[model samples]
Target chain A: MPVFDQGYRRFEGTLRPRHALGALVWTAVRPRLRWWLWLLAAILSFYPGLVYAAITFITLAVGPDAFGGRNRLPEASGAFVAFSDNGDPSQLVAELLAPTTAGIVARLWRISEQCALAGFVLPAVACAGVIATDRATGAHQIYFARPVTRMRYLLSRIAAVTVFCSVATVLPPLLVWLETAALHDDPWFAAQTWSAPFAIALSGAVYAYFVSGVVLALSSTLRRPLVVGLATIFSYLFLQVVSAMIVHGLEDKRWRALDPQYALGGITAPLYGVALPDWLQTPWPWLVGLVVPTLLLAYVWSRLRAVEVAT
Target chain B: MTSTAPVVRVTALEKRFGAVRALRGLDAAFPRGAVGLLGPNGAGKSTLLKVLLGLLEPDRGDAEVLGLRVAADPMAVRRAVGYMPEVDAYVSGLTGAASVRLAGILCGLPGRAAQQRAHEILYYVGLGEARYRRVEEYSTGMRQRLRFAQALVHDPELIFLDEPTNGLDPDGRDEMLALVDDLARHHGKSIVLCSHLLHDVEAVCEHVVVLREGTVALSGSVDDVRKLERGTFHVRVSGDEARFRAAAEAAGMHFAAQDGETLVVRVPDGAGAREIFRAAHAAGCVVRRLATVEQSLEGVFLRAVEGAAEARA
Candidate 1:
């Protein structure tokens, strides 16, 4: 028999009080935050500043007469410059821009909602494969062999997607809302628009949870990230198309409740203190809207259970 | 080491998966140093490892590792133990260094500490040159070394190495075995090595746990397990065969000389054949050849498992 010797030394180092969730968060975000995302952030950060600049130019150059007759901003940019300033210049520009609390709330909702949707797409792609890739690569063995539970594992992933998506969804609208508030000379800006930030926050959070649940659940079933990302886009588009056809061709407004996009919009109306449309006032739309996503999330939980088996 | 209880103890452990009972009232103990877990397919080797790692729950009874109750604090049990599974795995999109570093970090090391340890362990496992390469691009041997590196990165107190030499050439297999030996002997890390290869177990392990039908059929030091009974031998001779047989019979030796000029004799262990030689020499017979027949580990293993089946039948 040969004497066995490989010179493996015992390490005398100490293990730190680890932050597992924090480490996972760093890994998920660091790789996806490329130059393209930075460029997007720069644009979002300055858009409100650009809006303030545009408002200043219009208010000073065209004077209050530009707001003389129109209750809304110019529908098209080309016609915006040539509209004759013939009406009497009696009202202030700010006064015509936001005449009441309802009017300003509606504008904030529309802007935040639009930014939220745009922000949702890129981050969704980033998070689409987080759970799926882990299972596909058998990396869960490395994780579960440590001191982590399944719940913590799932939460860290969800939190990662939420934080990533917020970069696009949550941050932009609040910055724009702040700039809009600061530009207003009206004293009612503070009193009337106080709920605007909170509403946008609530809307972004709901959007994050819903999207993360659906995308990650899909992720658990598949081994490929490409499939998961494509599925996410397809599911959203398919739901919209189905609901649109029913609402347009069949003349049945209740089917709109099943539309994820429409449901999200209606769900945010109460947060912004806007009333639901007459067609969406019934509970069927809300019921299917909430139930379908919940069922999808349940499917995710079940799929995660299967994915947890390391072998 | 014998006076104290084993480092791991499973008492009356029972685990059932659907209609299959993977473990049935199983009981075993493992002391420190290199121990081999031997069992045939579906004999509960995988399930036992998972239970000890706190990855699966048993139906009844309990297990203890490193003096901690596994049920009370499974995460703590896992924290102290390193595990190398049979599955081929890599962290997607990560280099070898990053994957090992993440394993350390997930096992509770700080990020910087984990990274430093990763560099050290990669070199230790002979993966230094391939540390920067993407894990998915690694060859079979390199990936095997990477798995070993990940298990060693945390410097765990005890490690479970499952099928460590599953798919390797002779040289690769020998190198892997030597590394395990060093961990057990030099570093003093307690090891539970699971493999289907009997020679691999015999080469390194001092203790053996032979599991059959979800229960331990044989458990002891390998030294005791491999001992032969009565030291049987075969001797070939020619001159004065009748006189030698009479003399051997009178000397109270059990001999059967009718198997074609060969006498099969039983003697005490390590005493050699002094009585037979003396009888043959006194009877004017010259001894031609004498050889000791030792029992093999395979015989012991087959009897252990097959014996269990016989008893069941």
Candidate 2:
């Protein structure tokens, strides 16, 4: 290691290192984390979890054979009915719910698919105008002039918006999985559905990451917050519309992966052990799904570096 | 940190912007105190400042701020110094105090210390009552004060003020200048004041560096640079102006009338009153009034700029 010279000490008191990244993240997200908005996000996010939980409870209470064709019980009687076979009912129930892990994971994936709009809404609402508004007010000059590095600034802002989106997209589903798993007294239920939480978390992480990155990249390109926000929504819609038109016009469903939501679903479906449809079996969905968001984030980093250095 | 040392040093610094060269082998040193940075548009004042602040990298050369090499450790240099931008810069949706506190925190102060410094600096800058007001709602003067407060909240040893009084009214400008003077004199902070207003610089700064065409045209003490080589005397004579001009020319001096009543004469560098007296006596004119001319910073600035222009041509 090269020895460095310790120059004149400027201050008499103890000096503390600036927690610049933490400060930046807090400052960026604090104003947007209103109670009502968080409550709305929680309600929207937990809706699918609640629905999943209700289904699990109903299945547990009524018996898995209630909906199955194997049962010969009469529909008129409201009393509890069980098989007269010489076997334990609880063990039989555990055996029934054990194989339902695939269904549970598939339901979680479907939850993500159903709330695709929430992914866009949460990140867009959190970071829609963040970079644009800062540029408009020349706040970047002051920020870059401080001791905070450009990378720290960029990462902090991305992480701040990611917090909003991850809370809505990632957390609720995991909690719901935990709660659902706890409802069953089956030990194998824990072992069978152990991967369900990971699947939920992975799918949620991917969605949150892609949406936050793309939204911030869009924010970096424009100067007006309103325009940036509108452009984000419209661009996603436009891609979706164009992709649909092309898929219909060409009569090739593989073109559906050109849409971000469909591309994201392609990635999430397999995480839940669901097979893709014939058209999405191609690598186009995975390619576009991973590359597009990475490219958007790279663009955001470059734009921020340019703005900081070139200013 | 030492009063006798230069707070900023640039050696043969060069910066280019595609086809345009913003800084060309520029060399300058700003001593610890109040120094004014004077330049015309495109004279590399902003470029030099950015380089020193570590916002822009120099294409070729070395720069040091507070004895730390900027290229090697820019963040440290930035932490040691403060910059007040010329533009209206503030984080939107934040109050004045919040803005200052954020700046302090970003500059390496602890959160509580930053809060305390923000409050104290806002009050010191006369924004005490309006500290809670949103920065967007502030008037131009209040915004300018807010900018100053943020720059000073961290209490850096050096501060770069870019057009601090840009949009201030007369009273606000005076107050700002007074604060700058106080910082330099009482607080022992080094300041590099960049402005188009020469009087403002002359009023508060002890030294100045004039830039022309991406290079230092002149740099020295303000009083030393304002000193004219030849003594310029304003002489009011009661007799024939033609004869006084002829006699002044005979004495190897130049004379011009500032107005109908006052004739100005410039004597040789060493010779002074004797030549003016001899010229007046020889011309048979009554030397009613004679006073030496005081050079203005504007005159020095113009000469440096024009001199550099001529040299370039």
Candidate 3:
């Protein structure tokens, strides 16, 4: 809240509690209500991860003994394992769980990355579509004509998209973890795995925020939401593909800046186990990735504020 | 003579869209009345409303509403004036009540205050029963009323209504017109009613301004503009047309013969039908018909726009 006191008038400087609550509720409910199809699409998008998880689970269940003695494992009961041959029970249990744990971990890592990408791209498309629909139906003029400033309106919209992206990213992995814990009775296993979903969800939300800022900036300029959404998605993909092909050929580090995806990859390499030089991992990329697009969005919003509603 | 300097004032406002000018060096003032903005299509009526609402910037000149400059202190002006856009646009999934309440809160109303005001304004606009209904389910007329409801929910001193009767039935239009009239007449709220329909303006507006090609063509009280081109009178008589013509000419009245039995004469300003009756009686004519021809708003609007266009050419 910011105060503005003129000579004769005393204008209230703080946002009302109801407005903040309404913004949050609107952010949560509007995505599900306005574009349930997109929500469904988001859920369907995790099918690849689900398939990978299932394969890993089956491979782990039928131990390395299924691939011959190159991997020796015992048939295990709920509490412990008893080897049929002369074998150490603790050693057999370790061998049995190692491949399964490693596979699940690898799959989780890949799934988390995919989740981050989907979370960013899906909500960006949905929010742009929603705003475009409002403009097409003349609803934007009515909404903007109210006492609310353009900044408040855009903030509420972005908040809603972020909530949607976070929910989409976190829910699937949690469900999978819950199912695994229910079947395997591995308390340690569940505890070790829970942190991945939380981390993925947090990072995914940040990514979604950045993507939404860019998409909304484009959305304000373009008349058609679908065209804007597709162009943004395809353009990012095209840049990534082209950058991958040409980066190997480039000698200069500046060429990396041409590809946002590569730049983001380099930025997030620390979290993903791909180490960068200690000097390069200074939080600058995180700030740049998030703040630059946000400023661009603010510029777009000011332009929209100046637009006259066509009656 | 000096109350507060009118809620809104504009001096020599001008706006251009590419090569075609929308608002050409126009000056107007809105005091405390339900002022009607009468014009034809492309008359720059919409442009004027947008500029006054602080949504659009003018190419030249300045405007002040409630002592706040529109360009520099738009938020203050916006807080003081409620606007009902020509089109009906509401948050799609929101109920009528919620939408109005949201608008109230955005205007800085506290929770309980916003809710109470929303209820009162919804009832005032005659949508009390349908307050819980989603806006998508509302009819064109209901939505129009809802738009009006949102504008009034904040309890602003001034309101800008652009085509408030658009997409309304005859009865609905009448209801809206009456509501607008009551706001100005009884409550003392100033309003700028922008509409192409003259009848709508004539029903409630005390002051009228006609715009053509972004310039003021005719303005002042509705009576003053209507009186600019006075209506004529047709008197039918069972007497010689030549005699009636001679008498009319002698009296320095402009008269024309229509068919063989009627003499149409221009009714001078301030002269009534009784004068025509007396003239017929003096002429020894059995007056069978005496009809005072009145001009329609459409006719007045066309004549004004055409007059301005011709002058510009």
Candidate 4:
């Protein structure tokens, strides 16, 4: 037998018990992440706040009369009464708060629009390669060969994507809500709708589920990261656009069943107290919303095995 | 060394891939030090390794590695042992040291300890400078050594090296075999080298377990396993070969093979060439050449596996 002097010393340190799973969360993911994705998340985190800031400026500018002053700024028409009203600024502010149902829907729609925009794009992009790359490059063998189980492996991988997506989707809206409340002097609205924080958290959770569920399922099925990412983003946008077009063209609430956006909006709209027209309140959208994530989760359950097919 | 239990004691181990049976009642006990696991392609060697590592659940039976029952406490087995897989497997976009250190931490080492060990083990495997580079940029030999380093970074008591020299050249292959030998002897590590190359096994292994059709066909210490029949010698002679054979038989010598002027003859265990020389002299045949030919590992392996197949049939 051939022998060479290695001069290697034995490791005389104590090993922690059953720490492989925790270590996986720390070191399982390769640190060389796409910098652009994080940049996008950071950029997305500013969206709700930016929109709120812009709207706050606009509301303040358009309704300067509401601050116990006369309309000294600009003149407006019948629809712009909040701005054109030359009455007591306090009365004008209360009048704006108790606007018609259509007015509430229009304002709530704008918030939903921003949330939907970030929620759809951020989750799809951030969670694209959670498991796909592991399968692609045969890293699962490296993990499984350690003291980790399939469940721990899957959870960590999901957590890697889920946490990042939550940063982009959940945490931002929460911050934006705080910023909006702190800046706004609307006590009546705050009393009636103190659940804004909880609603943002719930909506953020919905977005995270879409990411961890559908995107993760797609990741498990494929071997290429780029392909998984594109597939996720494309599917999210495609289904949202197609369902919206079909529902609008038909002018039928029944056709809205296919729209995941509609379902998310339905759940989101109630939190904001947007009075939904009875024709637009279809449970199919909600059911589809739940079913899609459930099916994707089930797909992941059946697919991600220990001895995965070699790369 | 104080532990008397076998390094690995597997009984009736069975694993299946859907309808196809991968391991069918494989029973073998691997001992300490370098033990080679030899098998043909698809003979369930990889499956056995995965099962022992707890990467896959066995369909039936029990297995214990390093005195830890795999079925009952697989994490303990994984904690005590390390594995270098057969395929190209690594977390992409990681430097060799970073990858090895991550493997160490995941195997239960603290970060600082894992980092120190990673550097030491990488240096020990002759990749001290190369460890700074991403694994994707490594040569085949470097990747093999890197994987070996990862397996050692945690100071595991036992390691499973699967196809360690798969894509190496002759010199690299020699280097890998030498490393295996050094690790087993100097480092006091027990290793299971999974390879299809018999020469590699013969070079590094003190004991061997051969698998065929998911069962142990032959297993023993390398010396006994490859031992030739006693006093067997192949003699190539020029004059009166038949007369030489008859004379050899008359002298109570048994001939093993005949091909042209070449003759295989076996004397008693302790008997030497004196008997064959005397018989050749009596026959008046010129003994052109005579030498003992030891049975090679390839011969032993082919015979064992073929014999098992015949018995199964």
Candidate 5:
């Protein structure tokens, strides 16, 4: 055997593989924490309070009779009146708050989901930036020159970025929950009222994961993180707008399933007392919809895995 | 020195980038010493380093590092050899210590040990004070040192430093050179010093491989490769010019020129000094001084590169 071979074997025998997953996650998450913390603070300070304030203001201004009562408008008018027939003011209050609160929560959830979608752009750009910076600063050579292979290095980066996206997606819902608990007194608030928030949070997490995968894929192909980020955002917005236009223009009931907003509407129809079609009711569409984006992201990751550090 | 096989050996290694032939049938060996890879830009120095590291696939031929074939077992080779690349590259947002630790871990060191080794190696490379600082904040010299630290952290037997002193100041350059010397001499590490600076190479390297246009133009020990050309001498004499010239001519010595009280002469190789002394004494010339001129590495490198260029032309 060659001298280096003997030396390497001896060294390998002595050395242990360092599994610093926590350290890696910490390193990846720490930088983005400041931004997320500020976001969490903002969400906590404004969102739940905004919901409570909007509910309180609407209750005072419009009263409980506007929804369903003797005072209900046969001809819709800009008038506020209290009804004598409903009997239960609390139920009326809940009814008054439900749509507005759900609307606010759903909107907030959509915003979070959109942000999660926006986040998909980030990991790709972030990973690409990390790789590109490594190349620019000669770190890629330094890192690759060590015992680490390109695949391991790339995987570590993806892992780190995935952790970062997860934290970003999860933190907002957590802040909203804590804030709601601190502010609200409704017995149904925790059990019944939180379903929308939970769904929004769950969907956001899934979306974030999907986005991270897609971004990692983009990062592998493109060297410039900014280009990847901008391209991703543009592509997503373009797809959303075009898909919406096609769905709305065709008015084909089958194509409605393809529209994400419509799909979401279909999912939430029970809350609005609308009957969903049998095809939309089945689990297959949601499963297929979720799986398609995931598969595309996996395809992206496979492509990224093939990208060699050009430096 | 230990009767072990060569650490690295390359036979007719060739690489091409599409139409651009980067390495053309280059044969070389990196033995157990501080070996210098001297070449100008585009001379395949970087390509050769990458090939040795098993980072790039060779278009033809084969290379073995630490007994691991470059094509067949690159990971094995990488685990055995540490490389400092020619260009500036690093992991962003990581502290200098973190970067080194990451490299150490990838080299298979456990967490605590990797951290400890990272600190020690960084200190060795003069990055002790800056260990906690992010790599983005490091100066060019610090970055270079960190690069060296990463290479050494794995405790690899052979280290490849590509233009290790590129952006350093004079003091930094000297320190880097001293560190490289210490690594080779004291730590028993074999090094491949890839640099365009002939002076830096001469300062630390005992053997050198000079590449010209992707081929080995010359390769040998530093001393042997810089052998002085015959017929050059440094002479000092106090005598009449005419008698001195006549005496030198009569003795079959070629007189080149006179400078002040000295005469430059072309003495035959292996000629005894006593012959010149006697000839000068007979001619009533006082021989003040006599010495032989040695060739500089710069001269040898220039000649080798020029010769290769001429050969190709």
Candidate 6:
């Protein structure tokens, strides 16, 4: 019951609109930074990259001799000891480079996709309680009580999840790609696989944006974080199952786009020069991958605006 | 902002939630200093607060906060006013400091400044030591203080406190009322205190506005509202009660109500203590206590509400 009768002191400092968004994003993400679930998700996200790095190191150590003969070994890789001394060393450089380079790029694409899948845990954890907890605690009313607009609040939530996703999904694969390039020590291999990191980054970003958008959109509609988290995870599995049943029942592969993850892979695989699996191949992935997230995000914006005004 | 000028003004404010009219052509001007907003359930006190904060747009009419039209520039109005909502609301996982800082930031304070003010305001509201604890851990009183801290963190020109003393014990309620009074009287902050507790409002507010059925039932300074009737006094006497009653009635005085050993009598205009003393002497009773009884806020509220109902009917 102590009284603060020093009288109120007016604040003369000016407000910065730019700081508002950053403050909101920071506050939204700060609590989860120390949570064990987020840490576990971060580790899982990098697990694929770690596995890919190990594979690249082993392949580089075994050298072109593992592919066939000494003649198949690139000259640039002669720094390593030869496994076979009796074989002719006159094979074309393309002969030594094509299969191994193709194999490495393919492996990187697979790992990138794996990283995206594992990184689902990041958005699941990051966005689970963001809007749901706010709604439950009535924090959204406090936010709307201030000068904050509905659009700014929605943007901050999406940005926080996107940032978490980038760190968890995009950074690890790029690091793995850098490690792959460094271990090979062959200029020809580096030249052929230079765009692998970009592809990994691009596909990882696409995955992050898509999953974060869908999960956050779900979070906006619910009031319990645990329910939102479970629902988000369930949605992926449900989409996969329902899409597979439809694809098989009608004997049409085009409907595979209904499975967001499959559609995402179809869209991202081309960046690594890999096509969708023969049976699942279709032209719908590009449309589905790009359109679904956009629609969900638009829905989230509308929902937030309604909640702000109605409540 | 002069003392006489209004901190908030609404004209022909009409709001409808489907078929139910929450506010029907409500008009009010809340002056500077402490003003009490008193209303019962579904009286539109909460609706008016929301509209002033720009959280909800009125279906029709003009509203202004700190002279800025809410509809034309709600952000500017929000920048200058702070609100302590009636409902319990706080960021679940955030510490008290973080919650207040977030509010300050949303109101447009720079990050560092918001952080600084968060600490100062929490300490001001007596939560200095508990600033680091998560809001979920706070008690009812502490959470109320936290809400006040967040509302004051930005130091806006006007503050809207809805049911500020809703669940506090006597001591806590006294402390809150003292703080509110100090803010209005000493610190020069305009306050709109909405509460069902008439005593709390009477203790802290200078001006009062009572709402009924989404419209203003009564609005004026507390003194003026209570001063509606004069020459009414509470008289206490120790003598034969039958003789005393006869004597008072004979003196053109009518008993409006009575308490144990005390009589509340309404004296006719131009009547004074002389008439009451004469009546008591004639009754062979000693005048023990005689004092004018100012109408309580409850009386004003009931009269206003019931009067409005009768007029409408």
Quick one: best lDDT, which candidate? 6
Give the runs in model 3 whose Cα sits over 4 Å from its true position. A1-112, A168-202, A221-263, A270-274, A277-311, B1-5, B229-292, B295-300
Query: lDDT: which is higher, 1 or 2?
Result: 2
Q: How does each model score on lDDT? A: 0.73, 0.78, 0.65, 0.72, 0.64, 0.79
Show what share of the native A-B interface contacts model 1 retains. Answer: 0.56
lDDT of 3 at A118: 62
- Say what the RMSD of model 2 is: 8.3
lDDT of 3 by residue, B199-274 (tens): 9988998888888888877778777767654646667877865666666556656653354666567656676676
The DockQ score of candidate 2 comes to: 0.29
**Which stretches of model 1 miss by more than 4 angstroms?**
A1-19, A31-96, A99-105, A115-120, A181-195, A284-291, A309-311, B1-4, B228-296, B308-313
Compute the DockQ of candidate 5.
Answer: 0.23
Better structure of 1 and 5 per TM-score? 1
lDDT (Cα, 0-100) at A143 in candidate 5: 51
Leading candidate by DockQ: 6
Cα lDDT tens digits, model 5, A1-311, are: 11121121123347554444454445444544456545653453344334434544444346645346534422211111111123333433443445445543543343343344434444544444544444445555555555555556655666666654544444554555455544545545556555655664555555554555555555555677687667666655665577667656986445545544344444444542335555467663354346655676666545533433243
The full ranking of all candidates by lDDT, starting with the best, is: 6, 2, 1, 4, 3, 5
Q: In candidate 6, which residue pairs clash?
A: none
Candidate 5 stretches with Cα past 4 Å from truth are: A1-13, A17-27, A35-128, A168-206, A217-231, A252-309, B1-3, B228-293
lDDT of 2 by residue, A211-300 (tens): 766788889997776777677767778878999899889988789888877788888888888777778888887777777888888999
Q: Kindly give the stretch of ten consecutive residues in candidate 6 chain B with the minimal lDDT sum.
A: B302-311
Distance from true location, Cα of B160 in model 2, Å: 1.0
Tens digit per residue, CA lDDT, model 1, A1-311: 13222345566778664658877766566556668766765575335334534654455445656546544444322221211123322222343343465655654554444544444565557777788777877777777777877777777777777876666666766665665566566756867788888888887777677677677777877778888878876777788788889888888776776676557666776888767767777776556546665777777766655555544
The candidate maximizing TM-score is 2
Instruction: Give me the runs in candidate 4 sitting further than 4 Å from their true place.
Output: A1-6, A18-32, A42-49, A57-113, A123-127, A185-195, A248-250, A268-283, A306-311, B17-20, B228-291, B308-313
For A1-311, candidate 4 gives per-residue lDDT tens digits of 13134566899998775555555655434452578867886676555545544544455445544434333322221222211224333333332434433343334333433455456566566556567666766677777787776778777866666566666556655664555455556645545546666666666666566667767888888777677878877887777688778867987656655655556655556665655556557776566667678788877876866344331
How far in Å is the alpha carbon of A297 misplaced in model 5? 6.3
Q: What TM-score does the predicted chain A of each candidate obtain versus native chain A?
A: 0.77, 0.78, 0.65, 0.71, 0.57, 0.78
lDDT of 4 at A230: 80
